[model samples]
Target: MLAPVTDETLMRRIEQFIHAEARLQDEHAYEAWEQLWTDDAIYWVPANGADIDPKSQMSIIYDNRSRIGIRVKQLLTGKRYTQEPKSNIRHFVTNIEVTGREGDDISVGCNVMVYESSLRGETIWAARTDYTLRDEAGAFRMARKKVALVNNDRPLYTLSFLI
Candidate 1:
């Protein structure tokens, strides 16, 4: 059996994971980002609270590994209408807190500020990302990723990449 991680270690790991994910997305390394999840992983962007079931409520995005791959492919292909001319984005993650842990799985919550620039210039958006991670083979793989936007109910522009 594996020993549990200390609170400090767990927090640090969560922060590192968030930063790595942001970097991968900023660099447009979709394949690398996809590798961060397990085979059965789910990425969810809940419209309301994290507790809400995506199946019941409309989600900003609720994708499995295969769906994620398709999204990545669309982004990279330059065929996605929303991605035409492309948008440069930088994500700032902060307030990382580990809320709970059970066995190899840890629950983390953090705030994200994403700045995206296109022909229309820059737009700033904020959201909260709740992550569930599992320690597998001594590395962390995402089990569930839930993004709760402050303006989830508001109309959204087309999303070409993973948030």
Candidate 2:
């Protein structure tokens, strides 16, 4: 049997994982990022607000595992018009909190600000991201991720880059 993990160790591990994930996105490592998710993953970005039901309300993105794979595949093709020039992006993940844990699954929340720069201009997008991560063979895999963009309630520009 393995030794139990302490809260301090677990928090550090979570922070490291989140930081690495952010780096993958910033570097546009789509394949590596896709491999970090579980088979039953849900990637959601709510449109109206944080509390709206995705099934009943509009969403910026609500992709299941297969759809996630497809999105990554498209990005990898170098044919995605929006990403043709490839925006310079950086993700800042902060205020990470362990919200809950059930069996092998842990729920975490954090505030993220993504800085994106393209030929057109620069934009900073802020959001509170809630994630459900599952421990798979001693490694963490994302099961669900919900991003509540601070400007979701108002008119916005294209979200061509990943948040």
Candidate 3:
């Protein structure tokens, strides 16, 4: 059993994790980004609404660990038309809060605004992301991430990069 950690320490660690994940994506380090997840990880972006079940509804991205690897492979292949030239993206996570905890699992929610620039032009995506991170021997690994895009219900442009 581990001793209770200070709120400041815990928040700092979580902020580091979130910032690192964003950096990995912005730098196009797909392999390193994938390594941030556990084996049973789930990366989901719900369509229509955030609270809907992925299985019974459509999802923008509902990838398992294997599929995540595949997605990265496809992106890195340079065959993805939308990402041929790649997009200059910088997403910042704000208003992050440690919402709850259950044993070794911690739930976090934050607002994210992603600015992307590509051949097609620039686009802004705003969303509220809920993350469930599992404590693995003091290090944290992302177990699940649910992204609720503000414009999910409307048809949007292609997104080759992870949110």
Candidate 4:
């Protein structure tokens, strides 16, 4: 059987990766954020339950590597009007836990509170984010990032910007 992780150094590294991701996204550094993901990574946001199959159900945003790149490009080019004026955003990533590990993949669970301000007004969004990070040589890369927004079931304002 596989043993649980008890390495402080390794844990710190993972925490840094997650924190950096939050910072990059908040700063609108799309190019840098794109590099944090693996070539086959997935970014998914389910519409209903967190356990719902994205393929079988409606999803808010479900993107493969190609789509992820395209989305970033659109944002950078200002082609996505929802982000035309851009929203001032800050991310609070907390309650991070190393939930599991198997082979070279590590599962992490985190709670995020994103505060956004735009001409529309101020909004606070909360979600449970689960990430599967794959050890890439000495670094960790995101293999899958699934975000279950607390208020996803209702009519949400334009979430054209990155979460």
Candidate 5:
């Protein structure tokens, strides 16, 4: 019989997975980042407020798996003006915690601060991100990713990179 994993082991695995995902984004490896998601993934960034319903309220981004693919394609095309130079970005993920778990799904929350520098200028963006990861046979894939920008209620610069 196989031994069951302990909570400490599982949390370590989850943290490592999350850190790898962040590195993929920082490297602008969109294709690899997409692979980190499950087939039925949902990526969302609420506009104006963190608690707003994406279906009823405006959203900075609300993409399903297909839409995420399209977005990746757009970024890879070398045609997006905002991404022409591809802002140099490196985000720090902090306060990572496993909030809940049900069956194969695990919920995680963290705070992120992304520092992006482009021709225009350098900008730092802060946000709280919630993620639901589906554990499939010991592998983890993102099922849902929701980002709530700290200054979402105010005017913001163009967000052309993954958060």
Candidate 6:
């Protein structure tokens, strides 16, 4: 049987994972970001109060590797209109709580506040994120990332980057 993860170890690993992801995105390291996920990983930004089932409810963003690839392409390619003047985003993740864990997988929950600054202005957005991380060859890879934004139900503006 596998050994259980201590609270300290789990928290440290979770924070490290979150910070690494933030840094990767901020640096526009799409290849590194892609490697953070499992083969069948799912990235979801759900509408407020919406169900987790992607098929049933509309998600603000839902992506697998292919969709993630397209998004990366759009962001990197100068031909994409949104890339004309890229928006700068900083993600602040905190209040991390571990909900559960199974052999090679862990369930983590946290609060996120994202700040975006551009020539247009600055906007602050908040969300609650749940992550399912699985161990692969002793490294953690995200199996699922669910982000439920507080203002998801309201009308939104353009989102040029991953949240």
What are the RMSDs of all candidates, in order?
3.5, 3.9, 3.3, 1.9, 4.1, 3.3
- TM-scores for the candidates: 0.89, 0.94, 0.94, 0.95, 0.95, 0.88
Model 3, poorest ten-residue lDDT window?
Answer: 1-10
lDDT against the true structure, per candidate, is 0.82, 0.91, 0.90, 0.91, 0.91, 0.80
Superior by TM-score: candidate 3 or candidate 6: 3
Cα error, candidate 2, residue 145 (Å): 0.5
Global Cα lDDT for candidate 2: 0.91
Q: Which ten residues in a row have the lowest lDDT in candidate 4?
A: 1-10
As for lDDT, the candidate ahead, 1 or 4, is: 4
For residues 1-163, what per-residue lDDT tens digits would candidate 4 score against the true structure? 3355689898899889999999998999999999989999999999977889888899999999999999999889987776768889999999888888889999998999999998889999999999999999989999999999999989899897778
Q: Write candidate 6's Cα lDDT for 1-163 as tens digits.
A: 4344476876787789888988887776877888898878889998756465787877888999678777777776766555457667788989877778888888888898988887668888899889998978878899998888888889877777778
Winning candidate number (lDDT): 5
RMSD of candidate 6 to true structure, Å: 3.3
Off by over 4 Å in 2: 1-6
TM-score of 5: 0.95
Residue 140 alpha-carbon offset, candidate 1, angstroms: 1.0
- Tens digit per residue, CA lDDT, model 2, 27-136: 99999999999999999999989999999999999999999999899888888777779999999999998888899999999999999998778989999999999999
Worst 10 contiguous positions by lDDT, candidate 5: 1-10
In model 6, where is the ten-residue run with the lowest total lDDT? 1-10
| Candidate 6: segments with Cα more than 4 A from true spot | 1-5, 48-52
Better structure of 1 and 2 per lDDT: 2
Model 3 per-residue lDDT tens digits across residues 32-125: 9988898999999988987889998999999998999899999889899988788999998998888889999999888999999999999999
Tens digit of lDDT per residue, candidate 5, span 26-111?
99999999999899999999999999989998999999999999999999998879887899999899988888788999989889
Q: Could you tell me which residue pairs clash in candidate 4?
A: none
Model 1 residue-pair collision total: 0
